[model samples]
Target chain A: MNKYIQDTHAHVLIWLEEAANMIRESFTEQLIIETKSNFSDLVTNMDKSVQNFFIQKIMEYYPTHQILGEESAEQFKDTNREHVWVIDPIDGTANFVKQQDHFCILISYYENDIGKLGYIYDVMNKNLYYAIENAGVFLNNSKLPTPPAISLQEGLVSIDVRNWYGKASLERLATEAFDIRYFGCGGIDSIHVITGKFAAFAASIAGPWDIAAQRIFAKELGLCVSKFDGSDVNYLKGGNWVISNKAAYEDLLTIVKEF
Target chain B: MNKYIQDTHAHVLIWLEEAANMIRESFTEQLIIETKSNFSDLVTNMDKSVQNFFIQKIMEYYPTHQILGEESAEQFKDTNREHVWVIDPIDGTANFVKQQDHFCILISYYENDIGKLGYIYDVMNKNLYYAIENAGVFLNNSKLPTPPAISLQEGLVSIDVRNWYGKASLERLATEAFDIRYFGCGGIDSIHVITGKFAAFAASIAGPWDIAAQRIFAKELGLCVSKFDGSDVNYLKGGNWVISNKAAYEDLLTIVKEF
Candidate 1:
């Protein structure tokens, strides 16, 4: 019944919220900061702790549900699975280490490889953004309205700082926008896009755990989410993604195509 | 007596705080956005409102004190008065208009043509940074300790956003530092420099009202505040100013000397 599905979703949402809180508390303590591929690339012990928290919670609730997370599943190399839970324990490790308050915990539940429910929690603000497919998105238990359709020229855009320096695709978009901000957190950026604070967000590199929850919530809010080439986002792959209100997304694509 | 001067400073501080509250409330109602020179050159109704509020308070308490403010001081071009009060009612007008929270209220009082007191209120955080010359600095009544000396290589640098894209001096410093931030407020930038949150701050176009109080406070804390060319700062003109801890300031000037 519809009631059963809703109840199940609510239960999972509560569990995820609790898990996120655990991660945030651990983050408040010292984090074991570690460099990834380069000086700019960073990961932390809190990332693993949060991921394990979610993984353990899922194992206890639904043993059959597969789990994928940034820290533990980086070795998996593939994520095409049914009834899977995708997680990014800490989405902005760089910002976290720097004591910047723009990071968040992101999680998405997939049924047969299709996103069924999504959740993104901004820990600093203590706001949770969540959505079920075909149901409306909610921010901190309040239903969120669809963002107004704003244009590239009239709206603020969020650009990845890495892209602004030299990435041609990002630079091209930057030139066409009124203003750009780099808050150093992907989930926080997507939340702004969905809330109309930012008209669009473009990032050249992100993993499944980074965009999955925001992608589902954004779509439910009548926003567009896609790869840079205007293709459907492959949630399992590390690739460029752009999310925006309808008009601005198309305008951004036009510039991206020209580039 | 010291008590009389202290009482006068306290009285002005309380009045300014009230005016700041009024400005914040009015700004929240509606921004009334406008431009100064170009699209990037921004101003707002809140700027004038805050200025008027302070001017009225100054007139009511001490009509003999000459007032100079960013939004309403075009008529008073000469700042040679014996008891001139320089004010930037809202120091970060762009940030205010854009609904960003890093703006401040800057007030500098001169007695007999000599700097007497300066107060910079970070409105959003409610942290009031103030100093009377030779009396040391305080953040909301607690005396602030002198920040430790740090070099540009290991420190975070705060720069004006305009300098980032337009000049070789900023670009060179940006390349040498670990990171750079542009919070879009001169008073806040200078405060951060004095507090050790930033190793250095350099802006090319800040008026006397913006740096007068902060410069005195920085000097009292054993930090350096001077023109970029290592000359004494003239408070009557808008020009390049660099504030930093001792080691960083000397190192930055050495680099500027080459250019």
Candidate 2:
């Protein structure tokens, strides 16, 4: 790793830990909440507060760095900055507002449109999954081995249940894939894939912040990140993305192509 | 509570903790796994071992108490005994084999078909939720208050996504209930409803061990446990069932009646 990227990664790790602690402490506080795109899409006082906290730290450490965050994306005027940090202060806001668990913090650092560092911090579980480009991935300092390539017929997939309820793919999966489950939190659900627990995660709808860090992690972990039709994933403009073990990617796409 | 029941509850609590520890310890051991019913429905050696451990404890303390467990149900001949125990040594065995996190243990004691004591232990999380016949439910040492009567649209429902993926109910739930998710583990999914995090859980298929303990806890929590069509839930039969909060039960039923 280059000195600049290495230094930034170390600094971000410390800041990420601080952010996690902030979220843990906020559990006892009353969460001021509001609806977003719909009633199901929620935002809480902590969402904005956490984003602001990261913004302040980034500005202090590197004043020129640009940030695109869930709660404050409007303030991030499209810029040609070298260091761009994409963040979802709380990826699963509804889970955060309701269950107060399973949700996670997603942060990705990119230098000139190239991924540099990524982190998916499962706050409640105290699991910080981070990846440094080309150096390999680690779960709390323990290097993660490349997950075994599993086909859908012998694999479990975390699918977006809402989209498939009216689709034929759900039926095909019932008898095809080993089984299907949903955790409602993309970051936590993706952790299942990274650790070889789940074979794939089919997300029909997502936001930029919801998938940016996962995209970086997938690249380093030998996993496929793509649109269901077997197209490249536009991480900046999120939609239907299939994150899966290579062996299951094409098979799952054939099943959920309509979704 | 009567002295006999109270003493049994206390004694069982201690045994449940010991069982939880046994599960935690088995994580590092090489698991002997076999498929049951289907490739997705898995059974591990730990499941049999844990069941044997519980069986040993119960048979030693209360020799006359009859036991019905997932691993050894074949050995449990149909009986008309006064005291019967329904147990799932490791509920969500697929999860236990894959994630090793979400699966749990379910135990229910009945006297002539009347529930006397029930326990659902989330082994990884170390949450032992128990209920008494006349008394209410408790999580660990703390008592759980009555959950609010949440309506369908205002609540989260953990529905069987596989059923909706190919059925009409998926469309109905999309526009009817607030949202739907599935954890694939009946016991862990029910935890969401037991804590009021989810208003209902619609299971199209289940085994006795899957819903037996949940039914006992549902009764004391003022929740409804029945078929998705509002019929009765035969714990032994393992068919469609809807375990829901009072207000959302009928509303959810109206949406997925055809499921």
Candidate 3:
């Protein structure tokens, strides 16, 4: 690891801890919430505040670095850059507003187009899952081995429940996978895949911020991250994506692609 | 509360804590796993061991009590008894085998055909939700207020993911509720509705032990517990069931009952 990257990792951890504290404190205070795109798609006051916090820190240190965030303060056009940061301050805002838990914060750093550092902070659970390219993934200082290859028949999968309502996605997985579960939060649900607890996660719709951190971390752990059709993911242009164990990826793609 | 009932509550809580410890210990060791009715329906060695432990304690402490357990060694048929206990040592066996979390221990006690005391212990989360007949429902030591009546359009719901493999149950809720989620564990999913986090839970298939504890606890919290067909639940006979909040029940029934 480069000296600069090492220092940056420490700084990011410090910032994440501070962000987690802000979320905890927000729970005791009243939040201002509004919907985006649709009723189920929600954003809370903390989402905007947290996103602003990250942008402020990034601008102060790496002033010219490109950034793509959920609540972007100053939008930067997609470009090949030496340093780029992707952030989703609150990945599952609906869970944050209704359940007050299960949501997570996602942060990823790409240096010269290579995914260098990725962090998925499960705030309520106090879990920090991160990956540093080939250096391997860690769940809060504990090194997590690349998960074993699991097949659809023997594994459980998490699917965005709303996507299953149309019958096609639900029926395809119902016959192949052992069962399905929904945590309704991308970062939290994807952690199950990272730890080998679940074989895959298929979300029909998502934004760049939603799948950005997951893509970077999944690459380090030997997990497959691709569009629903098994094509390479364009991190800057997120759509339907499937993150799965090596063996389970093909099975998930076959089903999720149909939707 | 009578002296006998109060003492029984204390004894039950004490035994539950011990059972939780036993579960934690088993997770550190290899558990013998086997299928029950089919491939997805599983029963671990710990499930049987836990059930046996509870039965033994109950028999020794209250020999005259009639009991119905998932893994019953001594058959105690349904009889007119002053005390009857229903136990599902490990409610979500598939989850216990796969995720090692989300599973729970369920126990319900009835006196002379009337539900008296009920306990749903989420073993992994260490949340013990209980109800004492007319007494208020509680999670750990904190009393939970009766959840407000939430309408279908404004509430979240849970459905056994397997149940949605077919289009009937899926579309019934897809168009009505705000959204849907699946935890793959009945006890864990019901906890969401118990706390007003979710409006309802609909499972197409379940056994007596799967819902006995929820039935007792839901009654006290003023939540509706019934069959999917809007008929009364036969707690001793395994069948489909719906447990919902007061206002959400009618809307759910209007759709679910059709299936």
Candidate 4:
């Protein structure tokens, strides 16, 4: 049993390293940029290329792992596989095209419906955040210390403005926080929450590929991750989610629930 | 007259460079960050440091030249001065404090009530944009070419959302653009418009110092610089201003007037 777990994590790490290399090369090539739903929904050819690279690498090693990726996933498909790999090749496509630096590659691995490993790589900064459940999170070889518990009034939260305008949960959360920031990137926002750069991050409509990896690392860092209704996150479902430092989590959940 | 113009530009350049150096040094030293009215109203001790840096430099080198700055300027008590220097020491304070690096240093020179030279320094990138009226604008050392004319529906416009929410003119302008972006820096927005990175930029409230330098540069690049109502910009007063590529300027004003 011990050998199986170690082998799985080691294989995932090798794939992650290869993915990171592909990302770095594509970024330097000045990839073609395009729009998705609106001008704000920026997508680049690099996104697809990176996803293809990872999908190929995963197939070569873990052929049976069910693959779900942001650029290729169909919304309604049901893949209830015991081992699934979810990926967001380029999480901040807008920032990737415009700023060329504030984006990341995210990967989550689940085994027997339990999160086995999570990885988020900030491509430009060359910082990699990863964790295995019950094992501590690490930021590029250094184990990240658990952030100090902070309340809403003392913490800054990263929120997507679209969610704020569409739902009452965001406005309620805003009134209780010290400040709110929006950088238009899910992976970066998730990193901020776990690293203490933000007290919490609340967003709606994020996919499983988007939050699954970060959620695992955030949990290992002693944060509370939940759906808007204060329920455990279902890795197969995509919906509203909030991750916060422990002290602010209950209060945030209460405000979100009232909405 | 040519010698006088050269002398004036040279003097302003030296002083501006000195001020820029001070800004870079203070930022590297890790200045304290603070907020003004709200979290959005970001300010830092470095703002005052840079402002004072320019103010002292201006007085020391050109004592006869009038000085105006965001932090130190009162109402234009001497509006008819033959020579006036307008400065915004550190633009985009919020981005700077947030470690986002999109801020700039701005300075403008006017002689006998006419713009003589305009300089906007993008500090993070270390690129300086400047123009002498009738002499043409330049990004760093290269002369800037005029951008292709585009209409409101075909171009990106930069705006300050805070200003749009507060002003009727801006609200109307906001609804007429293909897309809008808010980076919270007057000088940065103006330079982007002048360089065609953004087709137009409209903000309801900016001091003369904020627009003085960029206005001359935009005009040299075939951009229209005026108040929202298509009236001339009065450097002695603070009001709404729009800088745009020619076609966009005309098309936008028509839409804005209807609003």
Candidate 5:
């Protein structure tokens, strides 16, 4: 890692800890909530508060770095900045508002459209999963090993079974695979894949911040990350994606692609 | 609680701790796994060992009490016994073999078909959730309050999305409710319902041991527990059942019963 990236990683680690403290403190207060696209798509005051915390920290420490976050994405118009940090202050807002446990924060650092560092912090569980480009992936500061290759029939698969298309795909995957699991949070579900707890996690839709961290983890851990049709995932614009073990990627795609 | 049950509950608690230690110690050794019913229906040596441990304890402590456990139900033929203990030593066997977490122990005490005391011990997390016949439920020695009433659209719902029927039911619940979640364990999923983390948990098929402990919890917490068609859940038969909150029970059953 370069000196600049290494220094920035240190700052991010401290910021995430402070952000997690802010979230934990807010649990005692009444959350001011609003709906985004739908009722289930929730945004609480804590989400905006956490994003603002990152934006302020980034603007002060590294003025050159452009920030794109879930709550304050429109403030930054330049998409092709040399140094960029894509973040979802609270990835699973619904879970954060409802369960307050399974949600996490997703952050990805890119230098000139190339991934540099990524972090997925599960705040409640105190699990910080991060990957430094070309170096290695770490979970709680320990090196994470490449998960074993597992077939669809031998491992569990998670999916977003919301609409009819998702329902149809779930039907096929449920019977073909060992079983199904859904944590309702993309970051948490992806953690299961990287840790070998789940064979794969397939989602019908995702935003850039929703999948950016997993992309770096996939590269470091020898896992596959791609769109539903097995195409390269665009770092800037996230669509339907799957983070899977190579052994089960083809079988998973065949069923997920049916819809 | 009578003297007989009170004395038995104390002895059972001791046995559960010893059994948990046995399970934790076995993690170091290679597991002996076998499939039952299907490839996904897994049974590990730990399951048999744990169940056998409970059977021996109950037979020695309360020699007259009957036992019905997942691994050794055939050994006890009389189903109409006055005092019976239903046990699932390792509830989520697949999870035990794969993740080594999320699986739990379920124990229910019944007197002539009447639910008395129930226990759902999450061994890894060390959360022992239990309920007395006329008393309230407790979590880890703390009294657990009755969860709030939440509507279908206001809370998360878990389902077993396996066959086509479950798929169709999931489609309805996914859209109608807040969203879907599945931990792939019946005991774990039912705990979510009783804790208000989820509004309901619907399953198309479950064994007697699967729903026994949950039945006692439902009676104590005021949550609804019934078959898919709003009928009484057979404690012994254990067919399609739903453990739901009263606020969302009707709406949830409307979708779940269609299949």
Candidate 6:
């Protein structure tokens, strides 16, 4: 890896640790929460604060880098920027507000629209899963081997079963797969796929910040990340996507794509 | 608690710790698995061994107690027995074989067909949630307070989304509730209800041993346990049951009873 990317990774590790502590501290006090988009979609004061922390650090150290974040006010439209950072301060805000677990912080770095470094920090579990471009994926600094291929019938799958046009697809997947589970968090579900515990994770709708980090990890870990129709998932534009093991991707997509 | 019950609970606690250690040790060796009713209904060798261990202990100590177990060869039919025990060595056998995290051990003691004591041991997480008749529920020896009432729209509910006659009912619950989650384990889901982490847990199908322990926990915690049609759940004939908060019970049953 390049020196600049290596140094940025070091900074991110330190920042995530500090941010985790902030989240832990917030648990002791009452949280200020508001709904977004719908009743189930939630955002807490901590989400905004954490996003601002990342934006400030990125701007201070890499002044020229563009930023796109879940809680950012201004839209980041300059696609031609050489360096861009994407962040979801809290990937599972509802889980964070309700369970105080099964949530994570997501951050990714892109150079010329190409993925570089991606991080998914499960704050409560204290597990940091990150991937480097052309290098490898690591969980808590331990290199992870490519997970063994598993079929939908041989392994479990986590899915989002909300009302959607693809309800039939999800039902079919649920019936055909060994079983279905949902932690109500995309990042945690994706981690199950990364660790070979789940065959796949499919969601009907998501934002760029939600699926960004998993894309990098999927590439490095030899997993498949694509839209429900088996199209290449654009990191900048996430709609509906599935991250899955190679053995189960085709079968899972067959059902998931029936929308 | 009666003197006999208290003495019995003490012995059960010690036996559970030993069983947990045995399970942890079994993880190091390869598991021998077999299917029961279907491909998804699994029984590992450990399940049988654990059930046998409990059977041996009960016969040696009580000598006259009627025993019903998941892996037992002969059916236990003497319902008039003054003392009876129901045991599911591993509540989530599929999870035990797959994830090894969400599964647990379920045991219940009944006197004259009334629940006297129940134990649900999450062997991996090491959380032992148990309830005693006329007393209170406890988690790892710490007494647990009654969970606050929460409506269907106010709290999450876990469901078994497998193919069944009540598929539409489940879909309705998933839509009307705040959200849905599943650990694919009934005991773990019941534990969530006991701790107020979830408003309810409903399974479309289950066996006697599956729902016995939860009945005891529900009574002590002031939660509602019933059939899908708002009828009393039979501890011996576990078909379809829901253990839910009083606030959510009616609304959940209104949807779940459509079958």
Native contacts, share recovered per candidate: 0.00, 0.67, 0.63, 0.00, 0.64, 0.43
Best by DockQ: 3
Cα misplacement distance, residue A4 of candidate 6 (Å): 1.5
User: Per-residue alpha-carbon lDDT of model 5 for B130-161, expressed as tens digits?
Assistant: 99999889998799999999899999988876
| Candidate 2 residue-wise lDDT, A6-71, digit = tens | 899889889889998999999899989888888788889899988999999999999988898888
| Location of the lowest summed lDDT over 10 successive residues in candidate 4 chain A | A161-170
lDDT of 6 by residue, A94-176 (tens): 77876788899999999987889999999998999999999999999999989898999988988775543126766677668
Local accuracy by lDDT, each model: 0.74, 0.85, 0.86, 0.74, 0.88, 0.88
Query: lDDT, candidate 5, residue B128?
Result: 92
Candidate 6: how many backbone clashes?
A: 0
Candidate 1 clash pair list: none
The candidate, 3 or 5, that scores higher on DockQ is: 3
* Candidate 4 lDDT score at position B104: 88
Question: Which ranges of candidate 5 are over 4 A from the true structure?
Answer: A164-168, B164-167
**Alpha carbon RMSD to native, model 6:** 1.8
For model 4, the stretches where C-alpha displacement exceeds 4 angstroms are A1-44, A75-82, A94-103, A112-159, A162-181, A188-202, A220-225, A229-235, A242-259, B1-43, B98-102, B122-159, B162-181, B188-204, B242-259
- The native-contact fraction of candidate 6 is 0.43
DockQ of each candidate's interface versus the true one?
Answer: 0.23, 0.68, 0.71, 0.12, 0.64, 0.51
Ranking by DockQ: 3, 2, 5, 6, 1, 4
CAPRI verdict (incorrect, acceptable, medium, high) for model 1: acceptable
* Per-residue C-alpha lDDT of model 2 across residues B106-182, encoded as one tens digit per residue: 99888887888999899998888988987999999799987878888878789767656667777888767777778
- Model 1 lDDT tens row, A44-123: 87777778877887888777777778887754434447677888988987656554356788888877767788888888
Per residue, candidate 4 scores C-alpha lDDT tens digits across B54-140 of: 778778878777887877777345646798878878887765655436678888878876887889988877888889888888877
Estimate the lDDT of model 1: 0.74
Which is superior by TM-score, 5 or 6?
5
Greater lDDT among 1 and 2 belongs to 2
